[model samples]
Target: MISSTAIAAPEIQHWQTKNGMDVYFVPAAELPMIDIRLTFAGGSAYDGDTPGLAKLTNAMMSQGADGMSADDISRSFEDVGAQFGQGSLRDMAFMSLRSLSAKEYLDPALDSFTKVLWKPDFPETDFKRLKKQTLIGLKAQLARPGSIATKAFYKAMYGDHPYAQPSSGTEESVTALSIPQLKKFYQKTFVAANGLIAMTGDIDKAKAKSLAERISSGLKKGEAAPKIPAVKRLEKSQRIVIPFPSKQAHVFIGSPGIERGHPDYFALYLANHPLGGAGLSSRLSKEVRDARGFVYSIYSYFSPMASAGPYIIGLQTRGSQVEEAVKVSIEEINKYLKSGPTDKELNESKKNITGGFPLRIASNSDIVQYLAVIGFYDMPLDYLDTFTSKIEAIDKPTLLDAYKRHVKPENFITVIVGGEQG
Candidate 1:
């Protein structure tokens, strides 16, 4: 058992380079390995008429770079036993590396990153192979009920908003993407002005600054990233049912939740834990899984984003038991909406969150990612410091009011794939 006592947030060093690149360094001498990440505001949201540009560009960053062959790039990282990878979500793409802090290992890794980011040699042969693989992966996703349900759910919830589009992109859109489109999108979005460089490990402030500058030097200052258009509110209740031959129905029910800066965020976070946010201890799991044994798992969560993110409750159950599972999920939601959480539930929830907070930032790579998010979202420097206290302050009545305001069962946009509407 862990104590609910507050843990101090780690102090971070911040600096800006000559080319307007914001850099954040958190020096953790505990480990001999250094973690570095470069994040740009290039994501699926930037996928224009040509979809998957952001993703494909990110994936191919190291396939060939600075006239280096794909084999050479992979071998260089393996030589030092370092890890290099890239990932993208709806809002940003990140290229990250973990390597030994020894000067011998460090310089080569930095040079490799510089080459990968500044001058990718997207060979024609590899591009075709990568694109075809992506297309095949997309087709596989279309065949799965879980994939179909999530795709349909997003479209229904976000409507015409760019957020409605799948991150991996549609079959038609990705199949048509040209090399020029990817280059144009990369040049536009990967500018220094639209990104942050974060480094953590056994290093002093000066070396970290130099490494950040060196890696980002090739990037010229450019315009801010293109903004995602506003998401129109989902007005009517929507139900999308797609038939598949799977034995279990994948059900996703949700509505739009809070934005990154909403004041109600802390309250919502606390309220959700007991409702369905906590894994085994969550209400949805207990009611739908433990009590009646209707399904294997039932869970709910809210993703707070730059704009209103979706509040989602998802479950998978036997096709014959789908209606029963949905009914139990609704019952739990309605009960929470009317009564909120009890004082005991609220106390335990806060206890678990505050206790588990430190583990969340225990690693250098973890801290780098957290710092990147803080810089990207414009969240306060002391956001982590104030986290526990904020959760501690929410009383029962306050949470009850929040539940009444936010969780509306009637407004839920329910989507079920591979199940019949009974």
Candidate 2:
């Protein structure tokens, strides 16, 4: 077990660029590498009438940009031995870069990165190919038990909310997207003021500041995107079973949970460990998989986004065992909600969480991502420093209160694919 004193938080410097972008910097000379992440409010929730527009727009960023073809962009980074990545989640879209801290490799890489961000070409041929590929992928997913359960589960829980839409989009939706729509969405959402930059490595404060400015200066000076609507409370329980030819059943149980920056988040985060978040030792895994041999795996987790996200318990079992598996899983959840975790369970959880904290920020890439999350969510700057202490302070009573406040077993929307129909 790791001790608290063995883990020390990196000193994070926070500031704003002249273009109104937020910046978080951690100056670490321990390595000759630097990692940068720029996050924008351009996720699927902002897709509006075009469901997969955000994801498509983000994916196209590196395909071609400015006057460079996709091959040109790839060769530029590969020649410098730098890495680039772009992705979108429910609440944010992000571009990341890892390069040698020396100006030679770093300068050229930043130029290409900013070009991709500020002036994506969205070549018609590439767009057509990507859209065809996405539609084919969506078609394949429709036949997958896990995919079907996931899509159905979100729809059941969110009920017409933007969160219900798939991040990759459905067949009809992706096919409907056009070059003009993609460009329009990109222009509106990928703006300077709508984003934050996080950087970590050998760079000093002066260089970091300049890097941040150079990254955002090319972005359109647009305002932040509108907030996602709050998730409504579940008025009734739903048990949806989708039939598939597969022999194994996929199960998803969840409802809307707390958002990032909620006061109760820490308590619930600790409380969830023993229930399903602790891997094989968790109650759900033990009860549903170990004790009964009903499933290959089972777990629970919260996907906390800018708005309230889903708190989910998921598992897969034999098609014939679906009913029994759901019954046992729900029973375990209800028991935990009723009595909470014991002192021994809570102590072990706290030890595991606190002891494991150092590994979460052990490298520049990890630090960059955490800084992105902190800045994007407006979390306390000292969040890492105080994380372990907060977990240690969460006693049984506090854990119970948080569980009671956030989780309601009766409201769970359960979706099972490849299960027997009534």
Candidate 3:
């Protein structure tokens, strides 16, 4: 049962910019600050033959723009006490700004933000420095067991798909990247039509609309990116083991899961919590770490991207205990696939999930991020309002059905790094 004090979902205001960008706004007058996010359909998925181009392009955004050096851009926002953030994921690249709602601060912050989007200089000095830093980081990651396991797991699961490529491109790919390629990718991907804007906090509808227009106007008008192709399910199970000298082995198990808008998403989401997502109380944690003392940590999660993302169960165990840990995990998963959760487990999970839902949107910054996701993925406008109700409605049979249909234990691909087999 939900609490009486559960916060009601805020009303979202939606509109479209003249150049075809979708915008979602929420007015929260309680705070004197505003948070804004601009999302574009230009993540690593659009890298085409240039694997790390998207991440590199995003990294270059604030380095230099509108004839200002990176320091100048930094100073511009610092003067107004605004915060700037930019990053790329598998399916989207996003830029965020948090500033005081007053026009004195908001105006200058917006000017700097728009200039970065429209006039990135991609200065030669910054590019060389960043590229060198990326290579060093990649080299460090390559030596880590967890990183090796993650890359191999994705490669084994996705095969030749774009999802197989690491969001941060390989050392070879990063080294091969040039300024011309980065500029071309920026021109094609960062456009008005491919954008979504979300804002929350002290702003009126008129001001929100104006802000959206100002941001979108700086982008070139171009067509939306092509849809990512559907992922083909694996027909057979495979295990890949890489040799490393670590005392513990990193293990990753499972296969490609559902897409963002899949009908079974919520059902599977609720079901996964008890399995491995609930930290120390999770089934995987209890069985693998607590009961058997195999490792310090173990967890599972589904990364539902625009295309079918991975459903991964990850853990680390002493090299000597690797086989037993894998055996127990598989047995537990198979049992779950056949028999579903108990009534008590289902009810407990439901209450836990519902009770915590309010925390997700408790802050204006959090709300802005959620709004950006809704606009970018075309999720229902009432998504937040209906979230708790939907989770509460899930029953054991519905959850079991969704799990059986989406997660196939028979076709699992396992990756282990740092053990005898590895």
Q: For residues 1-422, could you state the per-residue lDDT of candidate 3 as single tens digits?
A: 65823668988889989988888999999989999999999999888877889999999989999899999999999999999999999899999999999999999999999999999999999999999998998999988999999999999999989888988999989999999999998998889888888999898999999998998987878989998889999999999989998888999999999988788889999999888888898888888899999876899999898899999999888888998899899888888888877777788788788888898889998999999988887889998988888888888889999999888878999998996543
Across 1-422, the per-residue lDDT of candidate 1 in tens digits comes to 54545467778788888899989888889889999888888888777665678888888777898899888998898888888989888888998999999989988877887888899888888888888999999999988888899889988988777678898887888788877877777788878999998888999998888888888789989877866666666666777778888788999998988777688888889999998988988888888999998888888988977778899999998889988898888988988887877778887899888888888888887898988888877777777677888888888888777767877778789998985532
Any idea what lDDT model 1 has?
0.84
Error of 3 at 309 (Å): 0.7
Model 2, range 223-338, lDDT digits (tens) per residue? 98888999898978999988888888899998999899999998999999989999999888888999999998999998898889999999988988888989999898889988
Which ten residues in a row are the worst by lDDT in model 3?
1-10
**Which 10-residue window in model 1 sums to the lowest lDDT?**
1-10
Per-candidate alpha-carbon RMSD to the true structure: 1.7, 1.4, 1.5
Q: Which pairs, if any, clash in model 1?
A: none
Q: What residue runs in model 2 are displaced by over 4 Å at the alpha carbon?
A: 419-422
Go through the candidates in order and give each one's C-alpha lDDT.
0.84, 0.90, 0.90
**Cα deviation of 397 in candidate 1 (Å)?**
2.4
